[model samples]
Target: MLKGNREQELIELAQKMIQAKSYSGEEKQAAETIGEFCKANGFDDVIYDRYGNVIGIIKGNRPGPKVLFDGHIDTVPVSDESKWTQKPFAGEIVDGKLYGRGTSDMKGAVSAFTAAAKYFAEDTNRDFAGEILIAGVVHEECFEGIAAREISKNFKPDYVIIGEASQLNVKIGQRGRGEIVVETFGKPAHSANPEKGINAVYKMSKVINAIRDLVPTEHPVLGKGILELTDIKSAPYPGASVVPEYCRATYDRRLLVGETKESVIAPIRELLDKLMAEDSELKAKVSYAVGEEMCYTGNKIEGERFFPGWLYDQDEAWVQAVVKELNNAGFNPEITQYNFCTNGSHYAGEAGIKTLGIGPSRENLAHTVDEYIEIEQLTKVCECYYGVMKALLV
Candidate 1:
């Protein structure tokens, strides 16, 4: 239903969004731009929530199922700007691809969704009976699913469409993520008298080594659960002459289906217990990491860094509808799953909502230097989004 010249308009909007710096907790500018676009393009109700999430609503005359198209506006900070061949914020185009920080990770897909929603609003011939909500959420890159969880408190939809980079495939599920902190405690003493104090770093090193050899459970679709050491730090102000009193190592664990927080942490706790029994002085504890962040609106948001994994059966009505829509839009969409976590972890994972993903660009391209999205893929994604709206709402 999206006709001529609209494709260019969508690209322009994506360019504008990419031009803005929306790193993690700072998405106010991108949210405002998206809100203005929604209002200018005939969205029925456009408003910003207390946490700075922008939601555009289009209500129908009759009662029907509520459908949400969700996309996060925030992106990870650009590391090593000198590594990028193109300007990270310029929204440059080369060889039919648009280059920028958020192009593939997601601003391009968000723009496509906005364009499709505008098209649906402008057309007088089609009368949809269900409500359509397009949300440009915030803080997803820093804290996955926190903003989405907040949004669901107000707008709980029957179905959700996540606009994460899927290479235009239909993603039915993803592995969950958990941030775990392994802390080792010891007494501080002079560095020269090492035997007087237990070295917490040495105890932490053993735990890290043990975790590296862990064989996580594997699923047929979601693949294997993985544990990787992401960060390590020791306390005591850099330790000039004193032995470090505390050492903490952060582990990122990918959870398979049926793996709960308790189940995920059981192995690490067992390892700690074994080590403590071997040496009473080695005091180590394992606990889930807690995250605290402030939104651009100055609202404080906090949650445990545990995202449950989720999956929807291919035979489900929503999955079938998305498949039909993608085919109708002239795309050969393969059924797939996300390798990384997204807001789906909250919507479908925690809330048990029926959810699927379809968007432009490859999933692997996210967070890489010189990130870009193909223009053709962007246009196709717009058509696919419109097709989905028609399949579910009309």
Candidate 2:
């Protein structure tokens, strides 16, 4: 376990991260802080990817499996700052917990992984054959796996360990997610005569009702897929007296294994097609939503909203190795799964790489107001990460 000064240093690093408001598109300061910490702790190589992901490498004398410890630097914006009893960025400690934004969601785990790397780097007796990479990625809050996908193009790894909150348990996989937009088109006319124009909003209500009745596929491990209508809007806002020409409904769909972009979208498309065929005046279209954005480093990324789900078999060697390490560390290791998504969508889901997740905080506290992580759990995570690296590489 990390003790004394090392433990204190981990806490301080976590505090520093909490102080930086690296929300989604604005992760520059957090990336720099993590990068600087890596350099100061004797990392063999430190680099910032074109998209501003901070990567720290510790090369070994002999070659073995390439292992990556992944964590995102970006966090969801604090929704209601007034609801927070403590200063969100102060990293205040109360009852042995560090409270702040990104503390439980991720910053704490990032600091723990960095501390683990430092311990390994400073150990004279440490001998390993492989590469250890710690990546502090951006854009995970807004775009689930795009940044990690960018990082993978440069540094592909044999195994990926995500540091998202897992309550110190090991997570095998998560349900995939995708965004879909259902749009209804109609003729615009002055609101004075309702019969003169087809009302798109009126047509869209039928589509929304159909979607609400959609029964999702199910998986034994990942559980049932879910569909939630997150947003709905009509064009020509603040109109004095005009029929809206278009109406759009956005949905967040959780996918299970064997569910693809085509499968997830097929039902909605069919519903729209049927509705349009039934009424000549009603026209509607369904398609996956696409996100196009520029990163903090001025890198452009564009992709469909689908973030695929994945499950790593518990019997896999790398998984068993991690579980063994956790068990040896004096903790009862339990195999769990994340209810939300992470960078695993890129690594394990899309790239088909072996991946697992283990970290320091409860999964439920990720984006809530006044987030916090246990100080003792942080140290334990550090030790387990270091131990797992040694076991896997040596």
Candidate 3:
């Protein structure tokens, strides 16, 4: 067991991480803090992957499966810090809550797991089996699991633990996500004589209405495959008096297990095909959005917006053992799943590795102003992660 103010040390590290201002593209300071903490602690090795993710390792006495604890360092931008009661980066504690950006969205879990890994090593003295790897990942705020491909490459893990907020519950799976773009084409003409050209907005309106009538798919546990219209745009803003020639609509598509890029949008594609065949004036297409961003290390990270949904059987031996261990440790955590997308989209969804998420604080607290993780939550999550290490690293 770790001696002398271990909880205080965990709080200090979490505060440092919050103060670092690690937005999506910039995580250097937070990464450095993690690296230093790992080195100062009992980690056997610390490595920075190509995408600038910091990976800290604890090797056991004997050969066994490698278990990875993953948490992203990047946080969504605080659009207005002045609106918050506590300073967004101050990491202030008021009435037992540690307030700051990323505290709940996930820097807190990063700190918790890091401390747990350190403490587990100190307690066991390398007497256990297998290895524990903790990673502070980059660019997760922008791309859920894109940067994690690098971590997967560097450390081929037998299982992954994503520390997204779960309020101390064990997450078995999550609904994946995809950004689908639909566009309509038309001819631009003077507003006074609308018949002279096709108005793209009008064409898009028909497509949008048609989409509303289309039924979404469903899953037994994950709920519905929702395709909600998030936003729409038209070309030539402030057109003064011209018919818009083009229109684009972006839909936030929540996915189910076994969903693919092609499968996710096939319905929309077919709808477009039918519309085009019926009305020559209606021309449109649907595809998954692609995005790219620069990492703090200057490496480019990019991927298709499709992240597959995944679920693991609750009765699996390792998963059951973990649940039993937590229960025996006096933590009656509910066996649940994340409603939102997580880095599991990569590990479990894409890479086919087993993945689960369990962390401190409520999922609703993420990205909200005056975000916080209770001190009780912070410390318990650390202990829980230590419990997880004891359960899985054998």
Candidate 4:
């Protein structure tokens, strides 16, 4: 059982972190705070990696598969401050809710795990396997699973728990996200004499419509793959007297199980080919690229044109362990999925590690002006974390 003051300490820390406003690429201050908490509490091997991920290791008395608990320290950028009922970073406990940025999306989970770290350190009633690794990772909002890949290079674990907003339930799997760009070329001509120029925008319009017409594949657990036009740009003038020659559009593709790069790209490529076949003048081209942007921490991340989706069986030991623990603790664990992306896809899809998600949040509250978490929920999450660790490690 967690102490009252312990739960309060976790809430206070999460609020402080939210106030720091550690956006996707700026998680340094919060990471430092978490590192200090772990060290002050006597957690061993507390360390921060090159990517700004704060980690602490608690060695078990015996030996078994290593269990890792991960949560991103970053939060999505806040919207208009006025839109929030309370100051977004106040961490105020108003009517039982801790209102703040990242409160629900994740800082709450970090806080819960931090509390769990303290609980495991002080608790003598339970004993178990290998070790418990608590990871306060950076940059989860943007690229979903980049942290898993960046951190996995150092600590390879047998089981991973993603602390996303799961309302303290166990999440077996979730859909993946991906991105790519489409470009089209045309001859530039004076608008006064349209015959002298080919309009790339005109050709692109057909392609965009075709893209909308193609539906993505769906799954029972992971749902459907979706393609959204995130951006569009035109090169050359579209002046009253000039015609545009080149155009490009970027796509945000969310992939589910059975949806691969070939499966994702084929339909779009087919559309372009069909247009070209129908009209020799319609010379539209399709291309794919990754988003390899840099952060303040200098971690260069490359996101796919589409984020691949994944699913873990509910009966799997990884899932069952957490579920059983939650049940034992009087929590009727709602076994579900993360509607949004998280580090799970990367761990389950790319790294192939068994992963599950349980956290103190509701996914919808994330990225909204009303972003907040129930203080009680944050506390409950700590208990859930401790319960899962106790069950799995033993």
The candidate maximizing lDDT is: 3
| lDDT tens per residue, model 1, 1-394 | 3456897799899999999899877999999889999988778889799879999988876779888999999999998999999999999999999999999989999999988888875673437788889999998887788889878889889889999988888999999999999999988899999999888898888878888877888899998888888999997868898888899999898988778899999998998899889988989999999989888899987889999898888888768877887787688898888889999999988898888999898887889999999998898888888888888887
Query: Which lDDT tens digits does candidate 3 get at residues 1-394?
Result: 2345998899999999999999988999999999999999878999987788999998999999899999999999999878999999998999999999999989999999999998888888888889999999999888888989889988999999999999889999999999999999999999999999999999999999999989999999999999999999998777679999999999999999998888888899999999999999998999889999988888889988988899998989888889988887889898888999999999999999988889999999999999999988999999899999999885
* Candidate 4 Cα lDDT to native: 0.81
- Cα-based lDDT for every prediction: 0.88, 0.88, 0.92, 0.81
Q: How would you encode candidate 2's per-residue C-alpha lDDT over 1-394 as one tens digit per residue?
A: 6778998999999999999888877899999998899888778889998889999998877878888999999998998889999889899999998999999889999999988987886783446788899999988887889989978889889889999988788899999899999999988899999789888899899888877888888999999898999998998886569898899999989988768899889988888888778889889988889998788888786788999999978888878887887787787778978899999999999999888998987888888888899998899999888877876887
C-alpha lDDT (0 to 100) for residue 144 of candidate 2: 86
**Where does the lowest 10-residue lDDT sum fall in candidate 2?**
120-129
Ranking by TM-score: 3, 2, 1, 4
Model 1 spans > 4 angstroms off: 1-3, 124-126
Which candidate, 3 or 4, would have the higher lDDT against the true structure?
3
lDDT of 4 by residue, 123-239 (tens): 843366678888888877767777667777788888898988888788888888777788888898888888988888888888898899897777877766878999988976445
| Decreasing lDDT order of the candidates | 3, 1, 2, 4
Q: Which prediction has more favorable TM-score, 1 or 3?
A: 3
- Specify the poorest-scoring 10-residue window by lDDT in model 1: 120-129
Range of the 10 consecutive residues with the lowest summed lDDT in candidate 3: 1-10
Better of 1 and 2 by TM-score: 2
Task: Evaluate residue 231 in candidate 4 and report its C-alpha lDDT on the 0 to 100 scale.
Answer: 90
**Which regions of candidate 4 are displaced past 4 Å?**
237-241
* Candidate closest to the true structure, highest TM-score: 3
Worst 10 residues of 4 by lDDT: 120-129
